[model samples]
Target chain A: MDFVQLKKNCKKDASAFPGYRLALLGDCATQHLAMALKGAAYEEGIALSVFDADYNQLDAQTLDPSSELYEGKPQGVVLCLCTEKLYEAFTLSSDRAGFADATFRKIKGYWDRINAHLSVSILQFTFVERDDRVFGNYALKEETSFYYQVKKLNLLIAEGTRLVKNVYPVDVDSLERRLGRDKFSDPKLYAIAKMPFSLEALPLVAFETVGIVKALMGRFKKCVVLDLDNTLWGGVIGDDGMEGIQIGELGTGHAFTELQRWLKELKNRGIILCVCSKNNENTAKEPFEKHPEMILRLDDISLFVANWHDKASNIRYIQKTINIGMDSIVFLDDNPFERNLVKQTVEGITVPDLPEDPADYLPYLQSLNLFETTSYSENDRDRTKQYQAEIGRILLEQSFESFDDYLKGLDMVAEAKSFDPFHYPRIAQLTQRSNQFNLRTVRYTEAEIEKIAGDERYLTLYFTLKDKFGDHGLISVVILEKRERELFVHEWLMSCRVLKRGMEEFIVNKMIETAKEYGYASVVGEYIKTPKNAMVETIYAKLGFTDRGDHTFVADCATFQPNKTFIKE
Target chain B: MERNEILEKLNEIFRDVFDDDSITVTEETTSSDIEDWDSLTHITLISEVEDEFDIKFAMKEVVGMKNVGEMVDIIEREA
Candidate 1:
């Protein structure tokens, strides 16, 4: 749905949407963009409250320390500017190339000022050039052409964002290609209302811009569950056999090749892949093992559940194994019956209606934009391997009679201490995305983590566990605030993959160790109950802390001792 | 459809858009007459009218609208 429909839905039932605050800064009239954004945000479960400055108030809003933009205290900020206005500014001086340098300086200054003062995620747009023939195609080479200048500015903006902490460039160039520039702009509107973009394109811009906002707010998918047979390939695997299955660069099968290749790319980028198909295990595994043309291999799949069982139950098992929210999974099946069944049974899983033809699958999937992430690190490349190792560990646990015996046999070593540059992004990500085992459920941005890393009054610890199977990369974080005469546990978050493996016991033991070493009288912890965090609700009491009402618990530091554990510090 | 017929349909849309069943708009009525008719909500009203009447409105037409009658007149012309 576009902005108009979303706005109408929100207006019909405003209470259904959760409130999010945003500051809008623009060179031209931005009332339409602000309205469209709120509607789009509300559609994405963010009932947006906007703090938009008047036209041409970008300087006043960012530079003035006491401006309303600062006082409003928005969580996300958006800046929208077009080349028409920039071109107008350039014409004031015969030295046109100077405009490019001047504009860059102004933008970089705004970036610096915004960074210094606000702790908000800034979402800014790159210019989509107006196809004016100031120098025709030679505008491509001319440094003075507004088109080339905007292109250079966009590149600089992207490079600067890569280095700068919290700034993100929303590529309007890509969006303009998607919706043609002629369709996206209106000359009459630009002339009268100073609105460069057309009414129809406002929703498109709002939707893309809000994607960044949603990523900042920790509302995005993590896994994509797929169906084999007609879904992945053009033919059924069980009936068609390995050779009979339509695949490779021939026939209608090439579509399946395209789909498989895309899915593999998503897996490599840290999106977990799983199979929920009704087929014989050998038949399903046959293609990946024997077929030379298949793009996806066994190693790329984190979990494969190809069986006679209903897909909904298989999806539940996958969720239990992954320990992520149902909202974080997108299920794809060619069969409408299967899709509807899973949709009804699974509360929050996204099940898009697949087109009748297989050719449309890739384009339809692309439009959903299922996998959204804030940062990419080296750790992401081996995510499928890590999850596969986790599954191996789970299977090994089934063999041992006692869970403790399984823990002891694994030979686990945990590295726990204050944060460093290497673990900073994952550490911040854990705070943002982790829900079930998160104590207090406080989400932190990378900027806030940088602050926490250096603050003396707080103890910021990151934990990484590696055992016989593989390395569980940087799994847990604990932030302890030093109280007057005690050390209060400000936050304790853990990756659920490492849960029930004596890691929690080691973390708590370490907290008490710090309290005793620092000569603090007591160590306190709190468990805030969220719908998803019930598993860790009574965690403090289980660890032998005296329960105080209102989700608070405390223990004497002097009396605390290490629990039995296989982990070596 | 006649203007009165369109008004009947538009009133249904107004109630749905505003989330208030009691809301009844007339030719003389403007955005100020309704409690929820702000700049943000103006788009929702326009969208609902367009959908119900199966028409489109220009940016200038939407922004330049003075009252319910002007909106109805534009929709009728387009229809």
Candidate 2:
């Protein structure tokens, strides 16, 4: 496959929908590979910019900072060294330690500088071994020296990547196993095309690199539609009964328990767990509720529609019940028939390839690597409990005659705080994910968030909500960029759990008051429409914002008028 | 065999694996030269080539096949 075609496929994947900005930086050895990426970007609908440094004059700092060369805020950056060329750079400089540490430190410095300058994810590449004779230069003969240097550089980069949470090392060696040698060795193709690696290698890297970005960007499926029977346990609950099922302490039963434990972790991360099994509802309910050793519970599940219906239809009902998109769902079942049924019926649902061995369950589940959440809030620990509390609140709503009476009974408190370094990582994650209630779903990396913090014109607000039930954690994030006489609300998004809590209004009102104090004449905001965010379509309109076509809604600070019954605590 | 036939075969391999018939295989064609040609597809392409050409490529050889011409040369030698 060509890199271009693979890139197209990547764009089609739900995870890379809005796509990301990618920057390619490499030595002369990778010139063709870089150009091929540009071509791939054109075909795949992904935005990728390639930068080629002159081989004769290769200085990282000398490269133009503002040169649209690096203009796009790339989610991932690829840095490569042709083994022989690096050997040349090593020999060219008389001070070995100077070049060694300087080169390694420069890579780290690049990330530090970029973290301050660019709002994107970074991916660094290690050097691949080349046939010694390929290079015309002779002093580089101990090619092993360059190989060791490259390996050392990769380890250093990996260490740096580990330290900075946003950086990733895309080791070509791991990629080579998946893609063979014939495709990777063609120098002519690479030299001319700017893609010298195997036809197989590029897409894997492109997808993997993009996967890393998507993960860093904090965009992942929100729900897992599970099939009972062999999925949740080793055997069927109806036929085998609770005693016959294997879902208890260690050994054969322990594998299933481990899986259930994994599911518990997934649930804790705010992934709504829903059971869509084709069995007696009570039977399925027994394992979750009555089974003493069960890791997940009836309350743990957001929806339970266990009837003998087409699994796809059940999944559809769950999606609607949860008020989420079909794309944000993963269907898991041991039965190939059911998995195939859902895959054929549900257009966007991700059905991972399940293997035959029961022992393969952990690896199979791990392989899916489906959910990639970068931001974990304190609320994440008790997500199931909080959501259940929301369910309880729903039940109490029926008893109350008035909305305020119900609100007053709950004793809800909404607290807004300024962005602190301790919460920056999760705050940045919220910016990347949290789609539905988002004013403008502007995806950003933590590095970029740090940069935004330094700029005085911007304000990043974090909101914490709790009632008598439990702490809902930091659930909402709003970013405002202010200019002379006016403040622009760059981003505003709240966790779906806190949607109806009147927190959005409270935050907007806070922004308005803040703007007034700053002497800004008006507060401007935008309501960008997305496939899943129709819930917030009339938010600005309801808050007394005037529509300024093209989805930009504005509110004049002085003239703004709205019914406010905010009981701030 | 003529270089053109070899190129055509290589091009067919790229087209079939990439699922894009429009790709014309030049001697200089490499993964970076084409889009959608990432590491995963690179493996798929190599496996397809192994089945097509009936040749086993070593780690170094596979890594070395940077372009269509290089892939052709490696295949012809092994074949």
Candidate 3:
């Protein structure tokens, strides 16, 4: 969207939508940027209430205890320290050699103080690279030059913030490089109004900022639903056969190769890759199985759905089998008719407008930033194998006569243990990403998880499951707070991939066992209703806990019978 | 473009930017005549006019344009 359209969106009434409070702290004037942020958020069904700080008050607002920044109680704080202001500081500094480190120290102090007051996510804008070019080409070798310092400062911001779990660098430096410095900044506008970015660049910056907010709020794409023919490679796989279809590093085939390489990287990073195609099942499997030049093999895909039905129905089936929200899936198809059909049918799925030329596919997709994740762990690399095992279990279930028989035949094993420092990252990620099976959904960062692991008042458990097929790594998390006479289930969530496999029964039995061992008379569980968590609304009642009629369920530890499950703990 | 033609186009831009259909601009019309026009909207108005005319307004013209007639003069000269 352009500046005018985004500005007009600011006037629309967004009172009914979900609201996100954000405090915008910038050294430059931020009225226009605030408007653009709200406008961009409105387009995504988020009513962003921005607390725009006063002009050049970054120090005053962040340092003071009773400042408006604290009073606003924002869920997020955005810090924009522009390159123009940084250049002025560089020019006035007495010691240019230590400029980057000193500036980074001051910025880190702001993050530390704000985090001490409130546990809110800090979205910091990296310094955009700008040079006066006084030393020309020799500036690259000069550590004291403004250009060199700015580059080093950007790197320092990235590396320094890695130690803090709540601080997220917005990478505005990359945005400037992509848009070109001239297009991103206009000196005349900066001189007139103290605004750093041009009107045209404001919307892009606003979108990028809101993207991080969306991910932090537990809204992000988790899977990529792909089309095989023409979309993944050149020509139809059915007509061209496995050998004739283009993929590798020759001619237009190189374009598809690059796209597949990127998709492979995404799969390795925990984004589930699924296939929904309109070709024959065998024909679609042939290319992935037999083609020598194919970058994506049959093992890379989690759920492969190749049928003769319309793509919209096929995609819905894929969504149902994977047990993720339709909004978390991105559908890519080369045909406009298929794209429009799926776009109109699916309510929340993202279907990008694939360009006509095959070569423009990867570049266009990269610019959209379809995948934005807040947390990652080493366990993410094993996600594809877990899903593939799930598919294997599903196929095995079809041959069984009864559901109980299928569960017992799988030979499932589970391990439950208290929270360790090693599993904290994966536990926190499950809290942020799992929405369907979550009860009283409370998102915690890695730091909060670490605190909970050390605190005596809270009891934490992380569960892992494996069957005869493969291992589902660190699938569930339960955090219980000890009360006067009972244990309160503060947070309980599980990965949807492990649903309907007697995992909930296994977890509840473990919870009561722990409470009995601790000498608590009763265990209480609460179910908070959300739009996506209705699947688990009556879960406690179904698990034999007496409903207390006020969203709380009670189980007497003395009389509680251990739930019968197929899994051995 | 004729002077009257420029005025007619400016009237459309003014109505669109201010979200009003009845706004009619002439040589005497300025920021004071419009209820929503301020320093913030003034920059937006300048940007809209530049985009519509496919011309770049000088920094002076952006901040110092006295009336709708002055805006039209720049558009006429640049167009």
Candidate 4:
């Protein structure tokens, strides 16, 4: 999205957009950045309100809590403090190392000030090196060189933000390096308008900022649903019959093998992989099951929906089976018609325009950056097994006469434990990403988790469920806020990956048990309604709690009994 | 292409870039004339015109061109 176009789109009445106030704080000319971002936000389908600070007023706006930024109360704040200004100060001052340390302190001070005042997330740009060959290549070797100083400064900013709550760095120097200094900076334009970056680099900056914004909004592709045939390999599975399809480390097959390798690695990172192919079910299974060089096996796929049905319906089936929103999926098919059809039918399913040549597929997908995320943990690796086990649990349900019988047969063991640092990363991730099974959705960072765990007023319970088939690692979290003799369920959320295993009943039993252990009379559960979590809307009522309206339910420990489950702690 | 023909093409490109179908360009037209035409859009406009006309803009032409007429002159001369 270009600035002129954004300026035009900004003219449109944005009253209908779910408005998000974004505070853009900077020292140099950033009106264009703000304007360009408005257009970029429009492109990302985000309704943005840009609250930009005045010329060279970075310190004033951040340091002073009474500034317009705080008054506006924006959802996100982007700091674009110009490092070029440091050159003037550095050139005049003799204490180079001291200057660097002071600059680092000042930058961190701004971050601390923002953290002090607001609960909003910060997007800060790290310093880009301004080349001064006065020290030559030796300048890079010495700490006093502007080159070495900038590197140290950027490193300090990065290291400081690591594991710190809510602060994220956007590397402007990396962008400058990638685009090359000449392309990234137009001296003529900078002299004319005080615009630090050239107009060409504006779109890149805008998109990166928007990407982070979208991820924060919990609106990014969660799964990459793939299509078989010419997409995954060099020929049709129906025609090639597993033997003839080209997919190996050799010859023309190298490209397809490379594609499969990328997909497999993505699956390892917990991006759910589902297959929607038009080939016969058996034919589709043959490649995954029998092909010697196939990188993705049947086990790698969460759901394989292969039929003569339209691609869109298969995609819908995958969504229904996995129980994730359409926006969270990216469907890849080499055929343009199928891609377009799926894109049209399912409003938000990301269908990338694949190139005619299979070699170009990986590069194109990389450019899309379809699966950007804020954090990851060891528990992410267990995601594939968790989803795959859901299919098993669903299949086993058919043989059992009752839901209770299904639960009894699974030998489900629920390991009730408190929030441990080892499991805290995954615990925090669940609070952020688990939308469907979430009730009273309250997102938290690791720091907040630590505080909540240590607080006497709060009881944090995490559960890891293991059935006869596999272990669901840390799938459920319950936060109870103690109120005198009573307890309030602050957050109640479980992973859909562990659904239909009588986990809800088991969780309630544990909550009631915990309440009794803590000498509380009754424990209340909240069922806050979000569009994605309707599946769990009646959970509290179903578990024998009285619905007191407004999504609140209460149950007394006197009447509660531990629900029978094959799962044991 | 005649200057009028070049202008017509430029107007179409403008409409596409701005996502407004009602846009038209004349010799006196400047970035200020269109609500969406600013520094960001100016680069986009120049790139699109370059793509459409199969030519590259000199840095001088990119910054120096003031209106649709000057753009047409450069495009015509280059083409």
Quote the lDDT for B14 in model 2.
84
Q: What is the C-alpha RMSD of each candidate to the true structure, in Å?
A: 9.3, 11.9, 7.7, 7.9
Deviation in Å, model 4, residue A523 alpha carbon = 19
**Per-residue lDDT of A1-569 in model 3, one digit per residue for the tens?**
98777878889999988899999999998898999999999998899999999998888998899999998899999999999889899899999989999999999999999998887999999998887899897888999999899899999998987899899989888888889987887777888888898887899899999999999988999899999988898988889887678888545898999999999999999999999998899999998898888889999999999999989898988888778899999999999999999999999999999899989999999999988778899989988887788777877898899999999999999999999999989999899999999999999999999999999999999999999999878999999899998999999999997898999999999999999889899899999999999999999999989999999999999888877799997
The DockQ values of the predictions, listed in order, are 0.11, 0.08, 0.41, 0.19
Model 4, span A350-401: residue lDDT tens? 8899999999999888877787776668988878888888766776787899
Best lDDT goes to which candidate? 3
Docking quality level of the chain pair in candidate 1: incorrect
Determine which window of 10 residues in candidate 4 chain A has minimal summed lDDT. Answer: A185-194
lDDT of 1 by residue, A439-504 (tens): 899999888999989999998888889998898779999999999988899999999988888999
- Indicate which candidate wins on TM-score: 3
Q: Top model by DockQ, which number? A: 3
Tens digits of per-residue lDDT for model 2, A272-297: 88889889888889988888888988
| Candidate 3: residue A547 Cα off by (Å) | 20
For B1-79, candidate 2 gives per-residue lDDT tens digits of 6778878888887887677889887897778888978764675576668768877667676666767788888877888
* Runs in model 3 lying further than 4 Å from the true structure: A249-251, A408-465, A472-569
- DockQ of model 1, rounded to 2 decimals: 0.11
By how many angstroms RMSD does model 2 differ from the true structure?
11.9
Q: lDDT ranking from best to worst?
A: 3, 1, 4, 2
